[model samples]
Target chain A: MRFLKECKADATADLVYRVCPMHLLEPRELIKDLKQGQVLEILTDYDGALEDIPAWCAKNGQEFLGVGEDEEEDFYKLYIRKLH
Target chain B: MKRVYLDHAAATPVRREVLEAMLPYFSEFYGNPAAVYDLGAEIKEVLEEQRTQVARLIGARREEIVFTSSGAEANNLAIKGAALANQKKGRHLIVSAIEHHSVLNAARYLEKFHDFEVTFLPVDQYGLVDPQRLQKFLTPATVLVSIQHGSNEIGTIQNLAELAVVCRTQGVLFHTDAVATVGQVPVEVQTLPVDLLSLSGPALGAPKGVGALYFRDKLRLVPQIHGGIQENGRRGGTENVPAIVGLGQAAALVQGELDAKARHLSRLRDLLVAGLQERVPQVLYTGHPVQRLPGHASFCVEGIEGEALLFMLSRQGIYANTGSACASKALKTSPVLTALGIAPDVAQGSVVFTLSQDNQEDDVHYLLEQLPPAVERLRSFSPVWRKKMAAVAGA
Candidate 1:
């Protein structure tokens, strides 16, 4: 898994306490609103998102920008750059 | 026997317009809102429309409303949901002592299992939570405060704006259970300054089993009911389309009629209060005289039990409540009355009358006529009444 010191995104989808598939479903919907090359951040507490999001990015042809460190350590902040 | 129903706070008859609006959804439009097909898409649109209607009634954005099973569930979501999600900020919570059992119990659950400290805030004799007193309870660890907008049992409306502002200035979240106030009065969140609010469909002439919570935009809540992506992942379960449609229709109808309805209800309420005071001795009017719900009148009659008074009044074809329907059946002194510092004996006689638009002036007159004699008859059989009379005679 790639890690980044700092990353900025055009939009953020906060799915911190929401259930599993929502970690996948909401970002797919939210990323549609972003233009190519703009980064989208997904905040989630679900551990599975660490692997699923990276794989989903590869399958969907989007660039995975790696996870950014959160100071509180409560949730993961994963970033993706829309490639299409 | 003349029948008069004065228990709107316990339940209300669904309005005709609301029932009609809900009929088609039960069969013809019975499609899951989560499916990918056109049928599901159509049902999804209908659900969002209802969300919009419920949101507009409270001056909140459509996205801010999350539908739930009942007002109790909404309270659970607002209290437990918000608190759990924000626990990192603090493990402390505060709620008024006179809140509905739903709010009180939810807080207790957190304190018992989640290692949180909860403060059961006290209220004045009139059931008013003083804003200054609330401010003093705030700590750096305080995360949320839940106070009901109006009391279904006592007819008192909290000065929510003042209380909410205290929390706001301190950067703490504030929630109000508005089940008793939503359709009865104008409750625009834009002016109220609360972060969360709960409202029930039954209180506004919609069918029971449907309610909604309003959380400010971007507020995070841990889901109380775990399931798939329903209610935008805030609450889960197949949408109750028929009841939600009913709630929407009732909300729209009440929004237009609220002013006239409040005026009609208050007129009857004043008549009943005046008549009851004139004909009955040793009656104590409960809650605030002017700051209460417009259609609610509550009293404690000395020398009689409210349950027995209810039975006698029921025989006369009048339906009323001694307190909240749940607490009244327990046959114990109401915690609400006890919190207000009423003597246990006096609180035993607590009676509440909640009026709705359907009730007419004649209904109030009938209750006034039947209630005094009902109390008198109940007191005549009571040893307590004799003791009070003997003390009066000695004096």
Candidate 2:
């Protein structure tokens, strides 16, 4: 579970992790909990993350870097770098 | 001084006779029914008597009765237990979309967690399941058909007896969650032809934490809540004796007054329903209108949200509900209404009023009087209602 910054600069690796879907937490709650300049690595078993995460970040003025999806287990890996 | 309790579907207070029957069990003869001692045998005799009493209320053999922790458990046991036990025969199930969540969620779990195929048959505008639709969905792979006898939200009564006959002829297991309709209505399992029926105690004026499942014949049921040799090893764990006794007593009382009480409730229910409809505008009546539970008055106030109406009524000391479809903490719009083809506008604004034997005509009239003003206050805030009012005035 190494962050992108935590990895050795000389090494290239991708980390696979599993996280529970924050479906119970409304987006308003999620937006309030996040802060500026903090990197959020979320693991969610939510299929709609590709659309939901990016749309949510865009509405909240957060940067949506990339998304990883898992169809088998119905999960998602979303990377967000808070800009403001 | 006007107060109301229009949520009889949620619960009822224990009847005097029921409470009296339970008093001795607590103090006088507090012996385990399963023990071999003489006192225990006496307690066992009374328990068996209760078993027959409860069984007779539903026209089932005493041996078919097995008490459980709650109505929810009884439903789970009947639906899931039957499905799993008969999996070798088939892995498919059928049920009404308007079924209580206890049955609906159990079926959903079977589909999600297991390899069972589930077909949720749709209901009509009044929350009645069409027999033709159910018949069309039944296949050789269909192992069980689960439906609720009466809806807790809208109060529509399903034709379970007819549906049960359908399942019987087709060689599929039938389970009806009769939590809302049991005791209040004449439930004859033998005449009804249902294979399994679920009963809960709270609705019949007994305490919570007790219910029972009735299996008509010698059908195999895999134990759902397992651990001990209790409940014939079908539903394991120590018995909730006090509640069970209370439930038995309640059943006896219900059996004694079944016809008369039903008529009484219907009279009061109609009075409330008619008074409210005549007074309140844009009111949409729910359920089967006639074939519904004897005590329910379900309607949608055109403009006000169900939650808002419930909250306002609570403030007035008028305890009713948007009914059992309300979700955790923040309420959810009724799945039953949605399943019954109610538009979102009506479904979200729905309110359920379940009367009891105690409710009177004066109470119903006063409630009718109180409702118009409250509804007016809420309707004033609704954008749609406001716009419509403005347009009508201009016209």
Candidate 3:
């Protein structure tokens, strides 16, 4: 919540796509609408996605802004700057 | 990140020697063994030789070995095949509660499809099957008794010889899914008194897609896959020549270095277990301390999910398994751990560290150094830990 609201306020990144460990395929589809250089934030509880999202972003020519591992919430916030 | 593999029970990297032995079969000797050509005849002879080597590993005759695609398929053949073949003698079967899914599902299939009765015998807190309990279930109609030689999750090695004797005395066929124990420990078919034993090649440093089923000469099993007279008409299919060659090499290597590898694995396992106990005080050992597999060190850490622990460990390049590999993906507590009489909450935290001779003591040290912090970090986020702490504070 608070993070989603913060994501909305930033003109560069307008929305946040949420994902979990069970549904991993959603991230690619979620980021499809965004134009080049538009930032996207992903909130996920899947530990694998923390490493995977960055690698995927790099492979696809997107900028990976690194992850915020919320140790308290046991979740992660991954920011990617999409470059088509 | 520096990587360490601690999940040998699940799978292992193919050994170099095994791979080398397999290469020629894949390319040069690519002819089908069933064909009448000279190349095919040569390949067939090689396959028979490989069968002999695999048979030698467990003290079984080459003719008794049936090459299968996996341990699961081998288990299916043993359980269903035996059940179907012996239906006239008995319509009832018995299995231990903690058998792998292959055996359990095969028994269920028999019960559902062929109108057979199944009895699942319970295990003790240490996951040991009581022979007396097994005796209570055995009757004149009991056709077969299926149990695992060693549990993949809890590492509990059953008193299989005793259990096998009980089955033999009652004229019931005995089968053990020795997938987890065959290469890791000594499993002599000649002395074990079991009618059938399932083995996985991948579990023994060979390639995947190859396994073997050892059936006693006198015991009859209906062919599950009927067509060609392959595997002495017990299992039908084109032989996986490369994998079979690899399996043969792997089995021979394991048999030769059995004692040394067992000792090495035991030492590594003990060090890891002792280190974890010393570092993480709340951890509970889940398996039989002495009777378990030499390479297996399993535990249930208090107040943390096994997957979360595995994730954190994976980040540090230390990979481990939670529950049995077959059931780990489901996010359910292991039935094997539950069979050990553990609480549901504790059972959810189960982690198994299966070592092989390939792993060094330094890997265990690396794991011990990193594991406590991972557990602590995960426990901090766990609601169960908070609840327990709150109760403690209130008290």
Candidate 4:
């Protein structure tokens, strides 16, 4: 798992407390709105997203930009760059 | 005998237009909204259209509304969902003391199992939560505040915008249970800065099982019901298509006729209030006289139990309630009236009359004609009334 000190994203999908499969489904829909090569941040509390997101990104040909660290927030902030 | 129903707060007859709109969805257009086939896809579009209609009634975006089984469910979702989701920020929550059981119980549930601290904010004599007092209770640990927009028992409407602003400026989430106000008055989310609001379908002349919660855009709520991706995975289980359709139709119908309906109901309400006040001795009008629902009037008649009065009225084909339907059968003084500083004995006499557009002036006249004699009969049999009258005569 790659970690980043600070990463900027073009858009963010906040799936913090929304139930599972939503962690996967919403990002797919939201990333469609982002232009190619633009970064999208996904916020989720579901632990499964940590693995599913990166694996899904690899399968879908999107670039997994690694997770950002935020001590203040309880949820994980995973970043991805849309690669078309 | 003319049958008079002045308990719209308890329930209302589903409007004809709403029923007509809902019937097709149950039989002909019945399709699982989550299914991928043409039947399901078409129903999905219909569901979204209902979302849009419900949203339009409250000046909200279509995506912000989530249909629930009832207003109680919506209240649970708002209080528990928002609180659990934002627990990382704080563990403290605030709700008015006179809030519905759904909210009060949800807050209590959080406190009991989730280790969250809840403050039941006090209200004034008129059941109005004071904004200044609300601000005093806020701490950095306070994450959310739930206050009902109107009191179903007392007919008092809170100064929600002012109360909501205090929470907003303090960075705390504000939620209002608008089940009592949504259809009876104009409740535009654009004007009120609440993060969440709950409204009922029965309040809008729709079937009882339907309600909706409106959350401000991008507000995160932890799913209260766990399952597949229904309600965008916010709430699980297949959607109740027909009820949602009914709520939407009712919302649309009410929105078009709101102002006129308010005028009509309030006119009948005033007549009832005036007639009761003039005819009945020692009748205490409850709640704020002016800052109330357009069609609600509540009173407490001294030396008579509300239950006995209801029995008498029901015999005369006049129907009403003693505060809440759930609590009335418990034969206890209403906590709402007690919170307003009413004595327990007086609170036992609490009677609420909620009007709808369907209620006519003749209905009010019928109530006026029957109520005085009923109160007189009950008072005549009461030792308390005799003692009070004897004391007055001696004085």
Candidate 3 vs candidate 4, TM-score winner = 4
Q: Pick the candidate with the highest lDDT.
A: 1
* Per-residue accuracy of model 2 over B87-124 as CA lDDT, tens digit each: 87789999888777788889999999988999988888
- Runs of candidate 2 exceeding 4 Å displacement: A1-84, B325-329, B391-395
Q: What range of 10 consecutive residues in model 3 chain B has the weakest lDDT sum?
A: B226-235
- lDDT of each residue in B151-241, candidate 4, tens digit only: 9999999999999999999999999999999988999997997899999999999999889999999898887888888999899989999
Q: CA lDDT of B118 in candidate 2?
A: 93
Q: What is the DockQ of candidate 3?
A: 0.01
Question: Each prediction's Cα RMSD?
Answer: 0.9, 20.0, 24.7, 1.1
Off by over 4 Å in 4: none
Better of 2 and 4 by lDDT: 4
Task: Look at candidate 3 and tell me the lDDT of residue A37.
Answer: 70
Candidate 1 off by > 4 Å: none
Any residue pairs clashing in model 2, and if so which? none
All candidates' TM-scores? 0.99, 0.80, 0.81, 0.98
Chain B alone: TM-score in each candidate?
Answer: 0.99, 0.96, 0.98, 0.99
Model 3: per-residue Cα lDDT over B1-395, one tens digit each: 77999998888899999999999887888999978999999999999998999999999998789899999999999999888877877799999889899999999999999999999889998889988899999989999999999988888899999999988888889999999998888899878889999999987899989999998974667767866656644567799999999999999888888889889989999999899999996799998988999999999998999988999999999999997886889999898888888999988898989898889989999999999999998988899999988998999
Cα lDDT tens digits for candidate 1, B184-303: 999999788999999999999999999999999889999999998899888889989999999988888899888999999999999999999999999999999999899999999999
Candidate 1 accuracy as TM-score: 0.99
| Whole-structure CA lDDT of model 2 | 0.78
- Each prediction's Cα lDDT score? 0.94, 0.78, 0.84, 0.93
Highest-TM-score candidate: 1
